[model samples]
Target: MTTDYNQIANQYKKAKEQPWRTRTELYSMMNLIGDLTGKSVIDVACGEGWLTRELRKAGASEVVGVDISEEMIELARRQEAREPLGIEYRVEDARATESAQQFDISVSNWLLVYAHDREELGVMCRGLANRIKPGGRFVTLITNPALYTWQSHPPDYRKYGIEAQLPESAYEGAPVALTVHLEDQSIVIENYYMPIDAHESALRDAGFRDVAFHNMTLAPDPQVGDEGDYWDHWLKYPFFIMIDGIKA
Candidate 1:
């Protein structure tokens, strides 16, 4: 199933306001990133430039946001026009992006799952790795491949208002739909279900070293989005996993 994100760009932006995205995934992704102070960063598949703006605020000396959808890039450019963060948004697919200088750090959030196959996944990984200079790092958060075997049992992260259980017919790398329940609405997004092993192999083929996975972690902050105790149940079952390593 080809997901034309351009059709759902607005909905995707709205979905980001949900706790699962604003709090859980964002916190975990940024945490795995450690620090961006004085780093040159690239936000791949940067829909609407949300992270591009935040990257500059996070202290990246230079930032670039890239997405394939012209509509997505246009929205990002609109944000740049309003605040003028000096960030650049290019409408090139990650597999085909280029620059004179590779970035010191590249961050992609919940993006790679869009790849339709292992070959495409390898292309994205290679492209992202090639964009990083020596001593640089690349990090991303993607749906946990463990869910592929969830033919019946579902992850116990309902408290966080998110859930995904593969049906009897679903297989790893197959298209899957996830419903994000926000305070005011519920939206579903399509993502290809690639297993973690496939991701690891792709990264390795792309020349990323020390590829490691970390479960989502909750910040101690009591007041973030809604239920303060939501993470208690959410922590037991990680819906997503963080993968990061040094660029080779």
Candidate 2:
């Protein structure tokens, strides 16, 4: 049940070579968080800092990108050196991140679903809430449980029940690994497929106010029309969800 940051780092390092959806997803997340001009942001589960770099480019004054993977941090550092922007990358667990620094906005893309359960997810949400200034925002992008339930392979209704779908894959070839949670040991991480209502309820329980959910459709970049048709269909029936709220 240990969170293998190394495995995640390795996966993300090879992510850039994949198709355009990766970039499209990141862009979609950025859009959900809105303009970043002159704001201090914390990117939780930041992976190799791709989104952090994008945030800087979008005019965020400062960004702290934190991930659980040391190897990912190393790669992120290396990438940052090539295009020096005022972004800082750190290897830290999302559930236990403790920094004196507060932020204007806290964002987690594809992170919440990986938490062990509602308890662990709530802990992370509360931690992020504590790290933001009043009136600041917390925005997250997660795999839509409904979409996973509808499209997952084998259509195994027993494990996940007919009401929910278990995530078996993240991309075309990448098989999603199964994880088991242990109370005293490091919990194996996997997506917690919950409906949108459950997600909003959990966020509210974590002390966030005014929770809202959005269905984001990734638009095909006119520049990459047919090459990005898969993304077009994806957007039409997006497999992801965007949620945002403010700290009370």
Candidate 3:
């Protein structure tokens, strides 16, 4: 929760399109989201608003990008100013943000990973659910619970952006750090280890119905190229877990 992405924003943005993000995570999540034509979307923890812009290009009529980091918001705003997308960016905590259920869909990339405890998890889910129309969905791409808990080092972990060196080892709500290999450098950030059960409980308590998790796949994509088959071990354990929460 204390990770300073502002300090590494430029490096991260530059590496955001690396296979870990663009190829596997975003590629899978966007597939799950399908077409957004004519839909209004709210992107939580939108960071540089890259995905927000993509949503607009995908035909989202209106989009709002929210983040707790002012630096991230500033960068997002600057980009918007340079190339207008009509996307609104705001600095708001994911746990406390209030809206009038105006959005048709809510999506977050690495937002829930900041929840440090049950209370925070509950708050996040509630806030996400509250921002969307009834029956609307909250789709999140998160660090996979299975991979986070899996202790053994996979042979192809690095290929999938996982590091064998874990900063923390304990299970269930323990603070952990993940190392991501980028082109020029590596990045590590602290994220709480919330198990799948805990995530489900929090979502259910927050009034979400039919919480389903779609495991990340090694499905071929333009970004992945031909080496996808080499990382069978990576696909066996999901590096990212996609969760769909329907507001009840």
TM-score of each: 0.89, 0.78, 0.89
- Model 1 lDDT tens row, 1-248: 46677887777677667566756777777777877888999999898987778888877889999998888898889878988988999987788645566999988887788887898999889889878997799988898777655533566555566666455564656777777666776667778878778899999888899999999876655554575565665666567889998887
Whole-model lDDT values for every prediction? 0.79, 0.68, 0.79
- Could you tell me which residue pairs clash in candidate 1? 173-193
Estimate, for each residue in 1-248, the C-alpha lDDT of model 3 and write its tens digit.
57898887876676677665765677787888888988999998898887888888788889999988888899999999999989999988887757854688999988888888878888998888878898888898877666545546422377655564444454666666677777768887778778888889988988889899997754466654576356667667766789997889
Best-performing candidate as measured by TM-score: 3
Ranking by lDDT: 1, 3, 2
Off by over 4 Å in 2: 1-3, 20-23, 148-189, 226-229
RMSD of each: 2.5, 7.7, 2.4
Number of backbone-clashing residue pairs for each candidate, in the order shown: 1, 4, 0
Which regions of candidate 3 fall more than 4 Å away from where they truly are?
148-156, 160-169, 219-225
lDDT of 2 by residue, 1-248 (tens): 34466865655455444343344467667778888898999898888887778888888998999988888889889988998897899878777746688899988887877655566667777777777888899998886655544444433322211122244543321223433222222223345555566667667876789998887745445676576333455555555678899988
**Where is the poorest 10-residue window by lDDT in model 2?**
156-165
Better of 2 and 3 by lDDT: 3
